[model samples]
Structures are given as C-alpha cells and as structure tokens.
Target: MTTGALPTQTLPELPRHDHGGCINKAIQIAETLCNDRGVRLTPIRRKVLELVWESHRAVKAYDLLDRIKPLETSAKPATVYRALDFLIEQGLIHRVESLNAFIGCNCSDHQHELLLLICNRCQEVEERPALEVMNAVAKEIAEAGFHVHRKAIEIHGLCAQCAALELVR
Candidate 1:
C-alpha cells in the first residue's frame, strides 16, 4: 500500500492573486500526467479542465456545459459529463458532493485523501491534504473492518477572506 504524502497547504488570498498562473500550472500538470500515463487528453477534456480551473470556486456541471457551448458549439451534457468522468478518473479534478459541483485538484501528482474547506459566502473550495486526520480515519475504518473505496471530508465554512469581510460588516 502506498502511503500518501501530505502536501504543503497554501490557501490563496481570495481578494487578490495571480489566478492565470493557477490555470496555466493546472493545464501543464494535466498535460504532463496524461502524457506520462499514455492517455489522451482530448480537446474537449482539456477545455473542460480549463473551465474547471477558472477559479477556486466549485462549479456545477450545467454551468460548465453552458460555458463550454460557446467555444464548443457541439458540446452537450453527455460530452461534459464524459469529460468530467475522464478528469475524475485521471485524478485531475474532484466532485464536491455537498454542492454538486467540481473543482480542480491542485495536488494531482498522486492519489491522496481529500480535505476540502468550502467557503459558504464566496463558494471557493480549498483542498487540504490532512494526512494525520486521514490516517486516524483509516485506523477507525480498519477497526470496524470497513473496506473503503473512496474518502473525502468536506467542511463548509468561511474562508479567510470571507471571514474577514464578515468581521468588517
């Protein structure tokens, strides 16, 4: 069994930051990973990934489809879903179950447990590699003899910027 390493958590400054870098880095990582895995990152899949990396916010499938239609006129719901499925399979993105939305995975280098911090006010989702928390959870699951297939801990609250804004208000 491969033990996942905890990545350094750097939460973005929500008010101001170079988001273009985020999008570019994500695309580059996706391209490299696809090449390494000998899988095709088709045009549609790449575009879907780009759209998902547009921000740190969670986006709905229908929203992605609507945004993609302008660029990919032939795009349909199935097309978007297929692209989403492929991205998920490749560990390039994550599905935010609570909001029924998707967000780009910053740490796509390896498969690891997810700890998402979602801001209720701004809807931005931050992914944290809580290694200790996950290890504890794993221990408990093992004690219960539960075979875990997938695990993601989604905690919804105010992000730093939103919380600060609330304080001013």
Candidate 2:
C-alpha cells in the first residue's frame, strides 16, 4: 500500500527489444501461478493467453477468436470469452475498457492496481503500478461510500518511441 507516484516512464519493450523473452516469461509465470492456485490452465485457455501475449497491443475478443481458430479448431466466440473471463478473474490479463480490448498483465505474479498507457500510433499497451493515483481514487470512492470490484486507469497517447518517430516526420 505504498502511495508514492511513479515518475514518467517509457514502455519497457519500446524502440527495439527481444519480444520472444516476453512471451516465454509470461507463459512461465502463468503456469506457475496456475499451479500455485490449484487452478487448471486448460489447453484452450493457455492458447488464448499465448495469443494475447503475442504482442503488447490490446486484442479484441473476436480478433482473439480468429487467431485461436487455426490452432484450436473448436474455438468459438463463447469459448474465447469464457477463457478471457477466467484469465481476467485470475489477474492474468486486463480488459482495456475504453478500447474494448484485452492486454496481458505483466505483474500477474502479485496483485496490484494498474494504469495502462496505450499508444495510439503503435497500438501498444504498457502497464504501470500507479499506486498514488489508485490511492486517490480509493479515497474518493470511500468518501462516496462506493464499492469498487475492479479498477484500472487507461490513458491513450503516443508512447516515447512513437513520439520520437513523430518528431522525425
């Protein structure tokens, strides 16, 4: 419950980086978490998670269904949605409400409040532990006697890499 604001930060995968490591790390974490929680990460669910982690960009449900169909020929809209719902419940992924899309949660090893920085140009989504901002919002909710089941702040803009590219143009 530390309430310190984070300084402005850049997307960790920006510019140029080896993204294959990202996929591997995320999958490994998901497997460990599932085993620790005694929850079964079924084949379909694992596939959906892999597809979502294919990039940092937010992915829509239908898009996920489409991508998964080739691998999981039995996949349907309902199948994808169910897997998504489970992933969100387990804190393995997040729904970007404004964008109506989903993004993999990098901090799935622990529970935390997050802020999503979405780049309009590159369609990449970065997750941040914006503790101070979430604390403020919690205080406001308490004052209003409101109960929040879930909370995430999403801000859309150009990520550092995209902004630098803009300058060059």
Winning model by TM-score: 1
Question: What's the lDDT for candidate 1?
Answer: 0.86
Q: Residue-wise lDDT of candidate 1 within 82-154, one digit each (tens)?
A: 9999999898999988888999986866555889998876788899998899889989999999998889999
Error of 2 at 160 (Å): 0.4
In angstroms, give how far residue 137 of model 1 lies from its true place. 0.7
- Tell me the tens digit of each residue's lDDT in model 2 across 55-168: 888888887987888888888889889999999988898998888889997686555577889887667889988878888988999999998888778888888887887798
TM-scores of the candidates are 0.90, 0.87
What's the true lDDT of residue 41 in model 2? 97
Clash pairs, candidate 1, are: none
**C-alpha positional error of residue 57 in candidate 1 after TM-score superposition, expressed in Å:** 0.2
